[model samples]
Target chain A: MYLAKIYVTYKPSILDPKGETVKDALHRLDYQAVSDVVMGKYFEIKIANDNESDVRKMVEAFSQQLLINVNMEVFRYELIALSTAV
Target chain B: MYLAKIYVTYKPSILDPKGETVKDALHRLDYQAVSDVVMGKYFEIKIANDNESDVRKMVEAFSQQLLINVNMEVFRYELIALSTAV
Candidate 1:
């Protein structure tokens, strides 16, 4: 099996209110050194497949089509072995 | 400046309904190879500090107390130079 780790983040131009809120909270909590925070989604998917290339294609297609809103978000992923992932 | 990328995930024994929902959706979308999905939170925090160790310490404190529910979730982070992050 292959493990696909995907990160879906907001586009640079998009303002993430959740991130801004977290940053503000951090500032209030005395973490003044924290200047900014960008919150995103992380997905760890286990694919029951062997071919790395095929797994990559499948992850790529699903991440874009089913996971992210292309207009405001962007995604990136890396594939690794299931055994090594744990 | 330093960038701390934090990944907060549920403990192995915890139940993640959202992850299971996503897995079901992926199967419906023809990604039959997808056997499992674990959804988590990703944080990219930009710390305007020069000391890597201090930045790590601050991130560790804030991530635990403010960002995650320590009882059910665990977090890991890696710090890198801001210039190298983007």
Candidate 2:
């Protein structure tokens, strides 16, 4: 098995309301050093396959088709080989 | 300035309905190799401070008090020193 750690985030050009709200909240709480906050999504996927190439292709396809909206967000992932005990 | 990349995820013990839904969708889409999907939140925070310790303390507090729910979710973050241009 392999574990895929994926990060999906809005394109830098897009406005992130959640992030803006959080930033305002931080400022209200006196975290004056905080300048900006951008919010996104993360995923941990456990793949049942052992082939690295196959797993990568599958994960990439999944991200493009289901996990992210390519028009608004971008994604990246890292794969980790899992121990048999898992 | 520094960039804090934060990841907030549900504890393994908690049920993740969104992740489960994604997993089911993947299976339906014929990505049978996908065994599980765990969803989480990602944050990119830009801080105006240069002091590493102070930034770390602030980010930690932000995660605990605002970014994550202690009972259901846990968070981790990495601090990166940014270029003056950003």
Interface C-alpha RMSD per candidate, 1 decimal:
0.6, 0.8
Residue pairs that clash (backbone atoms under 3 angstroms), model 1: none
Q: What TM-score does prediction 2 earn? A: 0.94
For all the candidates, what are their Cα RMSDs to the real structure? 2.7, 1.7
Q: How big is the positional error of residue A13 in model 1, measured in Å on the Cα after superposition?
A: 0.7
Worst 10 residues of 1 chain B by lDDT: B77-86
| lDDT, model 1, position A4 | 90
Backbone Cα, N, C clashes tallied per candidate: 0, 0
Q: Please provide, for model 2 over B1-86, each residue's C-alpha lDDT reduced to its tens digit, 9 standing for 90 to 100.
A: 99999999999999999999999999999988888899999999999999999999999987899989999999989999988772
User: Worst ten-residue run, lDDT, model 2 chain A?
Assistant: A77-86
Off by over 4 Å in 1: A83-86, B83-86
Could you tell me how far off, in angstroms, the CA of residue B12 lies in candidate 1 after the best superposition? 0.8
